[model samples]
Target: MAEQPETIKAFVKLGEFLGDYCQFAKGNLEFNEDQIKWLHKLDDLVARAASHNGWFTQGNILYAFEQWSTALKTDNLKKWLDQYDIQNSNPMTVAIIMAGNIPLVGFHDFLSVLVTGNKALVKLSSNDKILLPFFTEYLTTLEPLLLGYIKFSDEILTDYDAVIATGSNNTARYFEYYFGKKPNIIRKNRNSVAIIHGDETPETLSLLGEDIFRYYGLGCRSVSKIMVPRGYDFDNFYKAVYSFKDIIDENKYANNYDYNKAVYLMSEFKFLDNGFLLLKEDAGYASPIASLFYQYYDSKEYLDETLKRDADKIQCIVSSRPRRDHIAFGDSQKPALWDYADGVDTVEFLLKISNNN
Candidate 1:
């Protein structure tokens, strides 16, 4: 069997595994009454498991599985693979450093390596090691052959054909310094933002809550800030977003919000009024809070310039205007499998690895 055919076979096997996983997710994991009850019980166990470490919480566990299942759909995986000519390349090893901000944030990198027929040496984040193993355990059960190719390591970072690293601006600098010599994708601190005109309805704003608050505003895809017209009243926005109050009870997230809020108040910084959150107008694109951070623009021209000036740091721009392909409020975090970050085609990157080998 040629390498390309073997690679294709692996992808087909993965697709079959994903199909089963999707069924399990939708039927058993997500909407199942029995499973929901089990999840509640599992939450208690997870809380106990991480009690000393102070890392994992019930919400984190739930969201981790939720994202894992969402990304595991057969159609989504197949769609991502379609863009590449995977049958041509036979990559040996691909190094990936997965991000830890959101649950299963590294799944896309995992998919890229798997579908492209490369052995994956994953450097899992300390904050996210537990969940990745859970996902791999399930995969092993589905297709034991896959267990041979996927390996997790805490140490032994090394030279590879290619690498992918996601991190903050400060960390990105270090990644570039270390991994820049290799064919690599080093992602810097970037964020999604919204462009809101006054005409946005309450329903739309509520959906935006999913973009802003889901995973407690941790994911890079999660909207960290908004661009609004000056003097915009936030009464409707607050009313819409109040439904997510439950997120505040999630220990780490609540602490983040409270801590940032306290720091702002203690420093006596002037911020725009949003009732629930203080929108500090700043020159930068990203903000600190788990809440929605926003900048006010007096005119459309100013908004355009602001976007252009910070284009490199911006990820997705959600807006009601039909001008751009801006996703709806809740849809930001739920990116389709085809959606690539930093304008880089992940499948293409993987294909390059396979082809170069």
Candidate 2:
């Protein structure tokens, strides 16, 4: 109960606004004088973001908004923060380096810094430059006190006590070399995978399509590969995912599909094709867009051991098994507030550094 109620209240109010925006986002929203202009501005932002980044489609942006709307509820916030004993700490500047693969991928880090009574100095990915600043504006409108706590930087980061950076394997090395001296959480690339047994129903396979295709498989949580039992029938899997074949209608995605298909053909690598998608028999976990790599497993025991051994490279396991840690199929994109990326707790990291300072 030591947590500030006003901060929580501000986020809850912002969540209500987002929910309303998602419901009647096409200029039909009802709001007071203060929020009316902001709502209009947000509508403009959706258009601008889509135009700025070809991968950030309007549907994906709206989906991100709706997901954040549901995640920012009072009850969910309380439950997520309940595990920690929050105490007053000297305010320090925490620099955040965000990723742009999917929409608003860095909001969690921004929220973690500000909610834990620290200032956030964010260096946004060029690919996702607009959404977070607009969100910060909305939060400051709700809680004027937060006006000083959030900042966006276009220059080299400086004057921060700690850093939280997310990027691919290459940038992670750079982050480590530069921010290693500071208290930091540097994240590298990790992809998700799914396990399939022969007995899955069509509904289960179809639902898995959402996991693979949402945000065009740009998210780290998206299933890039699958592990199936020996003699698995892919005809059923292809049929289940046929409904999403229209994904090739998008120009960027179709381009990638075509490019990758040509490369595979030129290399003379064998892969299965369904016009819109290519399935390859490979051992790697990270598959390119419009392509899925799969590996065959002979036994459940060996598959479990292999997954456990390579857990660090994996983000989430989508499976029908009752393992406590596995994410159920189709739920990978809908992570709860407590599902920390790379399994490293952000709140705890912030609190530890804050108390030390």
Estimate every model's Cα lDDT from 0 to 1: 0.70, 0.90
Task: Count clashes in each candidate, considering only residues at least 3 apart in sequence or on different chains.
Answer: 0, 0
Clashes of 1: 0
In candidate 1, what are the lDDT values of residues 44-142, reduced to their tens digit? 445553563354454554555555456555555655666555664355677899887766688778876776667788998876666566556545655
lDDT of 2: 0.90
Best by TM-score: 2
After TM-score superposition, the amount by which residue 75's alpha carbon in candidate 1 deviates from its true location, in angstroms, is: 2.8
| lDDT, residue 79, candidate 1 | 57
lDDT of 2 by residue, 1-357 (tens): 445567788888888888877866755656778677777788898899999999999888888888889999988899898888777558989999999999999989988887788899999999999988888877887789998888889999999999999999999999999999999999999999999887889998888998999999999999999999988889989999999999999999999999999999999999999988899999888899999999999997999898999898999999866378888888999989999999999999999988989
Candidate 1 — which residues are off by over 4 angstroms?
1-57, 272-276, 322-324
Q: After superposition, how far is residue 288 of candidate 2 from its true place, in Å?
A: 0.9
Segments of candidate 2 deviating more than 4 angstroms: 2-4, 26-34
